[model samples]
Structures are given as structure tokens and as C-alpha cells.
Target: MRPFKKIAGIAMSLALTAAMILPAGVRAEDTATDAPKIVISVGDEQKTPEFKADETKDLEISLKNQGIADAVKVRIAPVIEDANTWPFVVEDMNYERTVETITAGNEVMVKWEGLAVRPEVESKYYKLPFKITYEDGEGKQFQLDRYVFVKAVAADKPEEKPEEPKPEENGEPEGGEAGFSNSDPVVSGGGGGSESGKDAVPRVIVTGFNTDPGAVNAGSDFKLIIHLKNTSTKTAVSNMLFDLQAPSSGTEAAAEAPAFLPSSGSSSIYLDYIPAGGTQDISIALNARADLVQKPYSIAMTMKYEDSNATQYESSSSLAIPVKQAARFEFSELEIAPEAVAVGEEANITCSLYNTGRIKLYNVKAKFQGDGIEGKDVFVGNVDSGATGSIDGIVTATQEMAPDQKCKMIVSYEDESGKASTVEKEFSLTITPEQAPMDMSQMVDMPAEKGFPVLPVVIGAVVVVAAIVILIIVLKRRKKKKESVEEEDLLDEVDRFTEDE
Candidate 1:
């Protein structure tokens, strides 16, 4: 009986162990069958779509469940940089469901529309991000992320636009051209919209230029005025700068002027902003040297500015002004002989004239006009530019002419421009009887001739001889006079002595 009981207990324990292990395998198979499997793809249905500021567009997302079970707790949420914190926002988001469940071989279409917040602002592109989440029957969650791009266009009325031909796929019009059907997803951010289809470059035009005192003398100041207008329909010009350049042969003279230009060359002026279809004025003061040639010189004005996207734009225009030369002249000293000439003696006279005008003199001629001047004595000729010429001749007075007779002499010349000029001078000649020449025999007592005169030595000897003779006579007379005075005084003293006794 005891042996039979032991066998029964062993059989029971083995059976219980087998039952517990078998069910665990079956439950693992069930959990595997209930696991969720999903695939998510987000894309644009149109190849390229333009959305203006504050505009909304739909994005299509395909969700599929490849497992044998159904997907549950499906949720689609867009994750974006906080528009308020970033100064840009997507105002709204809406979703459209195509089918309730994704079967083993079926797919579900989810469409979402996103709105870009419109602010009274400039231009830029905005990007919005989206994320999709779902769970299977076993409660396993899956997530997928995606993005799309839009633009913030101006709020003005829509302009007329030409229709573009639709692209063909497999040699056929895609989606019949009713609307844009297939496109890649676009991502954008910031306060402005995409300018992909619009002209990214701004256009600049040089309208006109003017200057005060259209004509100027060298070394004078003038003001240059530049006028400009913005022609781009979309861009606002900022930090506009202009360079004023004189003609190739001319230069600017002010030191405080813009230094970006040459010392005698170019200058720059600044403008803060120029809106589309708006105009602005720029003024600059210039100084030209007095020595500048007489001719028309051109002033060229160039403009440079940046667009809304920081792109550089440039343009230029030119205007011309005439530069005139100033007037200026100098005279030469007049020449006369002795300033005092004896009658019957010849006198020489000479005079010269010069032109100092900035302008050239053409066909220049000189003439002399005065009394007692003979036609042959007067000299006349052309004075070459920037040069001096003289007139010289001898004048002889008649022997019978009265003494101290004065005669006027004149000199004249014509400018290269055929202008006449004159100068006058006066001189006198004295009349005196002529003396005969001395005989050679009278010169025998003289020593060998030397340059200059020996009259100074002869005068000195005469003075010394006269001084010696006067001294000798003065000593002899003083001795005789002293003796005679002594005799007279003695007799007077004798008489005085008798009277006293």
C-alpha cells in the first residue's frame, strides 16, 4: 500500500509542471500577434505651391499598418519653434481623415492645413513642423516628424500672372493641370516668405543729376545734386551710398569730403532708406582749382545700396559743366638815356609789354605813338604766348633845337585775341654849344693814362701848397707887428709915470 501511494504523488507533481509551462508559450505567441506595426510618410501633393502671407495650405500624410492587428490612439501634432517667442507664428492647424483604420494591405490618408500668422511686416519665408503618433493593440507607440514651407507676401491686391505649363510624368500631363498635384515638402522659418519664384535681385536706376553754378572758375565751390528712385516692386533699399566722381581730368578739392574717393577724385554720400517707387536727393559740395583748363568737365554719380535680403545693388549717372579761365596781366619798365641828353646827341629808348591773362592772345601787335618819334624809330611786333619782347631804337635831335626839349615815347601791342593795348613814356634832351677837341701837344705833361680819372690827386696837391704859403706869411707878419706895438706901449707908460709923480 505504501509503495502504491508514493507512485501516485510523483505522477501528480509532473503533470502540474507540464501544464504551467505550456500556457506561457501560447501567451507569448498571442502578444506577438497583438504588437502594432506602422509606416508613416508625409509629403506635398503639388510640385511647387505659392502661399502668400497669412495664407494656409494642406499637407498629405499616408499612414499604414502592415501587421494583422488594428492601430489605435492615433494622434498628429505639429511641433514648431514658438512663433510668439521667435516673432513668427502659425495661426491655425486642421486635419482631415480619409479612412478610420489601416488594415493589413490598406493605407489611411491624413490631411492637415497650416496657417501662417500675418503681421504688418516685411518679406520672408516661414517653416512649420509636424509630428504624428500612434499605438497598436499591444499599446506600443510610434512617432514620425515632417516639415513644410510658406511665404509672407505683401497685402496689396493680386497682380496679373501668366499661367505656367504643367510638367508631364511618363509623357502625360500630370493631374490634368487643374492644379499643382505632386511636389516636394518645403521647410522655411522667420518672418518673411520664400522668394524662390520671385526675382531675388533688386533693380536700380540712375535717374538724373544736377549742379549749382553750372559754369565755374577754377578754385571755386559748387554743389552737386543727385536724384534717385527705387524701381523694384518688392525690395526696400537700405544704407544707400553714392560716389561723386569728377571728369577724368578733374578732381575734388575739399579735404573734409568723403575719403573713399581720391584726394582730387571721388566722394561718397549716404541715404538711410529708399522705398519702392520712392525718390531721394543727395547733395555734395565740390571745389575746383583755379588752374583747371577751360572746357566742359563731366561729374559722374554712382549709387550703391542693399536690398531686404542684404543683396548689394549699384547704378550710375553723369552730368557736365563748363569751366572758364580767369583774367590777369604785368608790365615791363621803360628805358631812357642820361634821362638827360645834350642837344645834337643821340638818345636811345626801349619798352616791353607782356600778357598775363589765363586765356591765350591771338594776332598780337604793338604800336608806338608820341611827338618827335620817327616812324622807323617806333618798333612793332607780335608778343608770343607766355613770352616777352622789347622795342629798341636811337633818337637824334636837330642841332638848332631849343634846349630842354621834351619828347613823348609810346609802345603798343595786340593780344592774341586781336585786342589792342598801349603804354607811353617821356624824356628830355638839352641843347649846348659844341666844344673843339684838345690838341695832342697839351697832353705831353700828363703821366701814362689809367682807367678812371687822376683829377682827385691833382686837387689834393693844390690844397697842400696853398696851406703852406699862407702859414709862412702869417708867422713873419706876427713878429714885426709885435715889435711895433711894444715901442708904442713903452712911450705911453713913461707919460703915465710922470703924471703919477
Candidate 2:
């Protein structure tokens, strides 16, 4: 029994160890077989080709599928940087290109022609970097970065030659057609390597430009017309395309391109062909941002075209257009009439506004705004460029206001684009307590000064006279008693006289 238990325990330990070891081996194998392999390089003939300043050269790149999977939609482009130090620039767009497929053990080669180099660059070896992007059969994409060094050589200068004949009668030169100016061609090759006359490559030039409103103002939409001319006298250009490139650094303050302008993705216009000595005019609508400065801003234009036999070429030019600043105002000489206001009193304020920019302002208004204060807004109508205007309003102070308090005076206006702006001017306030009103009804009810009463004395005299009348009546009664006898004698005399009558 002990031997059996030992055998079973040993078998269990072995099985656990096998389970752990097999997974690591399987993971290693899966990782090794998961991804595809590819090889890319600059062609052997192009690896050490001589590069010249102010000259265009063709670059050949080769790509090979080294793994079992096929590559799909293989994209290739060149990326150059450090323009201050890099002696060469790819004059054509190198963003994207596609190849349908490259099966296992298969390879593909591509050519990038007409790369321009600076004229003043010295002879040296320069590194050119290229980016290749592709996907496998499962649509999984991958990117590879590769580079090659090229030697730059000094270009030989062209030999001096006799000048051409002047324009003859009927306005035509000896070797040129009528209406052709005797002045130098609008576009000329910068490189000294190419021979003069018929062997020279064709070029594109911007001959003239104009704006719809005759001027460009910040925050305004305007039309831009450009006249493009081909400088080649013998080669006609075909499949011509035009594009505008905006600066990335100052894009927030740059002029904007409408939907019609090819600011991104594709070219704005594609002409079937531009004949030799012919001109084409293109138009674009642009809007200047509000923050654009009052100076000339550059808009870069790039042209891509092919010659009569389908050889592609590209060139770029810039146009500097002046921009006028938008309407901007400042609060100057802000006067708070009486400086401070008393509670429950009408306060008056005035402010002077100055338009410091070239744009005009409309519906200019100023008013006093603060807690416990009320005022009306004063309208100054419109103010012209570099002009001054004044606005005044009245406000009433509330009881909550305190002495030496501070409040803001807000001046608002609109620019030519109907954009509103406000300038706040803070001023100190002196608030006083409200006075109490006088009461006239209380004065009418007030007591008179303390003194002897004349009416009371007159009443006392009437009472005394009544008492004297009663006493006199009593005294007269006593006298009548004494005079009874005399009255009887007079009565008897009267009776006798009556009988006699």
C-alpha cells in the first residue's frame, strides 16, 4: 500500500510539471509565426546618386515581400524636417500612394521625381527619410521608417550667351509670338545646372492678385482672385491642380478658407491643360478671423501639373495681403458727475469712447452698473474709425449703498460684424443717509405759551352780574313791602279817577 501511494503521488507531480512546460513552448511558437516580414530600401542605382543645390533629382525606392503573407494597399511617402539645416525639399506632395498587392518573394519599385534642393546648399552627404505603410491579407496595417544618405555635388553654372532680339514691329519678338512681352519670364528655374533655352523645365507663376472689396478687413468675408501663368514657351502643361496651404502656427489668427477652397485633402481646381504662354485665373472666398493683426499676411499657393508627355511637376508661391484691424474701443475720460451720489438721489455719469482701430462701431452705448444703483443707458449711435464719441446716463442710488463704495460703469458697442464688446470702468461712490421730511400738521396741533386766559375772566364776570341781579331783586322786594301803603293810596286815587272818567 505504501509503494502504491508513492507511485501515484510521483505520477501526479510529473503531470503538473508537464502542463506548465508545454504552454511556454506553444506561446513561443505562436509569437514567432504571428507577424509578416518585409524588406524595403532605396534602389542600388539611387543609393549614392549625386544631389545638387537648386536642382531636381529622381529617387527610386524598392519594396520586397519576404514573408508568406501578401502586402496590400502599400503606401509610401517621404518626410523631411529641419528646413533650416536640411539642404533639400520635396517639391511634390508625398502624403500617400497605394499598391494593390505584393505576393511572397515579390518586389515593387517606385520613383519620386523632381525633388528641389536649396541653391545655396554646400556639397555634403544628406539623409532622406521615407515612410512605408502596408497591410497583410487580414487587413492588419503596419508602418516602417527607412532612410538613405545621398551625396550633394556642386552644380556647374550655365555659360553666358548673347541676349535675344528685341520686340519687332507688330509687337512680336524674332522667335516669339505676338503679344508676348520682352520682359523676363514670370517663372524661372532656380538651379544653375539645367541648360538655358529649350531644354529648361516648365514653371508656374502667380502674375497678379486682387480682392473683391478692394481691401481685406479683419472678421470679414471677401473674394480673392489669382492669375496663374505658365512660363514654358514650348511645353504645354496638363492635369493642372491648385491648392492653398494655411500656416499651422498662426492658424488661430489667420484668414479662413471657405468650403470651396482646397484647404485640405484635395486640390481646389483641376484644369484639363494650360497651354504654353497661357494664363488661368482662379477665385477663392476667404474670411479673416477676428484676432488677425493689422499687417500683411501670407497665403501659400502650390500648383501640381504634368507636361505634354505626362511628366509631373510642382511649384509653390506666396501672396502677401494687407489686413485691417477690427473695431476696438477704449474708455477715456470717464467722468462720474458729482463723483459720489447720495441715497435716494439721482446720479449722473458720462464717459468718452475712442475707436482706436480702423473698423467702425455701431449702437455705441454706456451705462452705470452696480448693486443698489439704477441708471439708464446712453446711446451714442455710430463711431467712425479713429473717432471719439460721448455717452451719458442717469442713475439713482439706493439706501443699501455706503459711503466711499465702488461700482462699475459698463460701456458696450458692436463692431461691423455685429459682434458685441463691453468695457467696464470702475469708479468710487460716496453714499449719504437720506434726510427725513418736515411735518406741517404737527405744528397746527401744538400748545400755545402758558399765560392768564381772557375768555375765563369774561365768563366769571357774567356769573357775578347774575348774582347782583338776584340781590337787587330781593332788595327791591323789601322796598316794595315798605311802599305797600303808598301803592294802596295811589291805587285808590287811580280807582277814583277811573270812576270819575
Candidate 3:
């Protein structure tokens, strides 16, 4: 009983101390600062994306933020380790992807394409791990571990007699050839297969392909080299006719003009023969359309050939060629309001960012720099093709500039492949010196302004002098009249005295 009471007392004391130290109603702010629950999943067959050895493929995953707070600066990288055979990309290549922010209840997709799987891995399922790190609501970074399953299947091949099943082994093996069939179709690079009679038709497929300059740009001509292989043990294909079908223009499945066309004459090219288990490389000159959009365009190669027994076999394969649109643009009438500013004063800069190319521009930003002024960098998120984005900002004068100086505005944008491009425009902006404080003594000694009214002041002074002279003349006349009246009164007084005598 004493021990139980002691433990309870300790617990109560700790709870009181924690309550005194922590703030009130703080369940949310602290809890939301933890790592977000980001769920990574794939909606593919059997819930696992399939990959082929010695082939390039794409894998896409969906990320959903289930926590209350948003995940910011989310960086996810497929944990590819060479020591363990998780071969998804070449060495020294950056496979990490960053998401600016994934708000709660929203999902985004991340994909890795052109991933070349190592040719030595056996056919089996692999548990793939992904390293995910993100900032929480309190600007605290944390890591959330997640995993996905991927399936590796054998490369597709022409239908052939499967080897006989081997006897049961003593113990179970991870990936072995114990249970087998003599007639199962193997998965091939072309992603399809067919079965006919006892003797199956030999398959002619494009095992791989490459471009001359490697990167195919729109409106330019490039050489495409395709590798044709006869996946047969003993049969030989001869007199082959390969037709390359470029992707159409419209969204409908119906036929339309293709985005790519052969440089010379027809899309059909001739190949002599491909012996069994042998490969052949054929090159074709193709010119991409100038108006082609920025995306991977699929080209279908239709093959028609004859076997040794004069049997006609037809097979079709398609490959996607990524086409990049050139980033081309020019500023439309640069404008600088008040084209002049004093020290510590601002000038308004306005312009229209026009996208004249077929590709969309992303992360558009602008900054002004010159001899004595600088502007705030403005971020214009995205600008579509044939669209105009407005840039309005202010540039403050940092120092006094010489007469007739020029200031420049630099506009930068990135393409779909993350390649950056910039365009600069220079405009004249005058900077005047700041006004000086006034002094009392200097104000008294300053000269009068130009064009003062000096003639009017002189005329008013002459009029005042003439009025003073007229007043003085009237006063003298009044004094003389008073003296005469006094003398007449005295004479009258003398005559009255003589009559009284």
C-alpha cells in the first residue's frame, strides 16, 4: 500500500509541474508541428508497378497528405542502393523530386521515366523504400518513412516451347526455375504476344533505338537509329518492310497528319534480313514539325516480313520520342514610368511578358539593375503559349546617377524540362540629386526669382508722392483765410468805441 501511494504521489507531482510549465489550450499547435502523414501509393495492376530488365520504363506514385497541416519542401527520393540490387537509374544521376507544398486532403503525382533496370536482376517482387522529408507547420523538418512494392518480370519474347518442368527442389528458393511450363508466353519489350499453330511465327521487334544528337528538338531534323531483333532460335526473317507511323495531330483516334515526317520520300524503309537471335540497326532521317507541342510523341513501326518457308508474318511495335519546343520570346514595348527618380525615391517599371513559342513557360521572374537603381524581383508563376503575363514593379534609386544612364530589366523563365532562359531589355532612366535642407542665412542672401514685377512697384511709389504735395497746398490756403477774419473783427471793435464817446 505504501509503495502504490508513493508512485501515485510522484505521478501527481510530475503532472502539476508539467501543467505549470506548459501553456494553456496548447493541444493543437504542438501536435500539428509533428511530421505529416503522407501516403504514397500506386494504382497499378496487383498494386505493384512492373519493370523489365534491360529496358527503360516509367513509374508513377500518388502522394496524399492526410495530416491537418501542410507538407512543405517535400523531397522524395527512391532509395536506390547499388550494394543491394535496386537499380533504377544510372550512377551520379539525381533521382530526387521536390514538391513545394502538399495541402491537406490533396494529392499529387511524382514520376521517374527513362529508368534503365539492370539486366542482371532475377524475376521477382521487390520492396522499394522511399526517403521522404518535409517541413511541418512550425517550420520543423522531419522524415517520414514509407515503402512500395514493385514486380520485375522477364522480358517479352516470341512464343516458343517452354522448357520442361524441373523436379521439386529440397528447399524453397527466392527466384528459381523449379515450377515451369513448356508453353507459357514470356513478357517481351513490345508488351504483347500472339500464338499460332504448332510452329509459332517468328517475332521481329525493335529491341532499342537512339537519336544522333540524343536530344530531338522541334523544327529540326534528326537521325533515328532503330535496333530490330529476331527473337527466334532457328528461324530467319528476310525481305522486311518497316513503316514508321508518326503520331497524329488531333485528339481523336481517327487518322490525321503526323507531327513527324520522313525527310526524303516515304515513311517506309527497307531492311535486308535479321537472322534468328540476331540484331540489325537501321537509320532514318526524320524532320519534326515546327508547330509540334512539347511532349513525347509515339511512333509506331509496322513490320511485314517472310520466314524461310515463305510464311508471311506481321508484327507491330511503337516507341515514344520526346520532342522539346524551343523557348523563344521578346519583350513587348518596355515601359518605365516617370523615367527619372531622386535618391531614395522609386520609379515604376511595367512590361508585358509574351510567350511566342509552343511550350509553356514556368517560374517567370523579373529583376531590374542599372548604374544607380535596383528593383524588387517579381515572380510571375506560369505563362501559357501565346499568352501575355504582366510585370509591374518598383525600382528605387540607390545612389545619384550621371546624366543619361540606362537601366536594364532581366526576365527569366524555365521550360518543361527545367532548362532556364533569360531575355534582357535596357531603358533610359534619369536620376536626380536629392533636395538639400534650407538655412536661415542662405534664404536672406538668395537672389530674387526671374521676371519679378519691378515696374508696378515704381508706379505705385510716384502716385503716393503726388498725393502728399496736394494735401500740403490745401492746408496753407485755410490758414490765410483765418488771419483775415481776425483783422476785420478788430476794426469793427474800434468804430463801436468812437460812437460811445
Number of the top candidate by TM-score? 3
Tens-digit lDDT track for model 1 on 1-501?
A: 474456445545544555564465455444444224354433323222344545455555555555556656666665655654222344455332334455564566666556344554333333445666555545455555544433344456685684673222122223221111122112222224425544444455556656578656666777766666676677677777777665334323543332122334447788999887787877777776555544455555666777676656566554555556553445566565434433333445555556555555444333333343332333334444466555555554345334355565555545433456555555554444432222222233223333443344444544554465456556657867897899889989999998999
Tens digits of lDDT, candidate 3, 28-66: 334434234443322212234678888889878777775
Tell me the lDDT of model 2 at 460.
56
Q: Rate the local accuracy (lDDT) of all candidates.
A: 0.51, 0.62, 0.67
**Ranking of all candidate structures by their lDDT, best first:** 3, 2, 1
What candidate 2 gets wrong by more than 4 Å, as runs, is 1-201, 212-223, 249-268, 285-295, 309-312, 322-347, 350-501
| Candidate 3 residue-wise lDDT at 90 | 66
Sort by TM-score, best first.
3, 2, 1
Structural similarity to truth (TM-score) of each candidate: 0.30, 0.31, 0.49
* Minimal lDDT window, size 10, model 2: 175-184
Candidate 3 weakest lDDT stretch, 10 residues: 176-185
Model 3 lDDT, full chain set: 0.67
Q: Between 2 and 3, whose lDDT is larger? A: 3
**Candidate 3 global TM-score:** 0.49
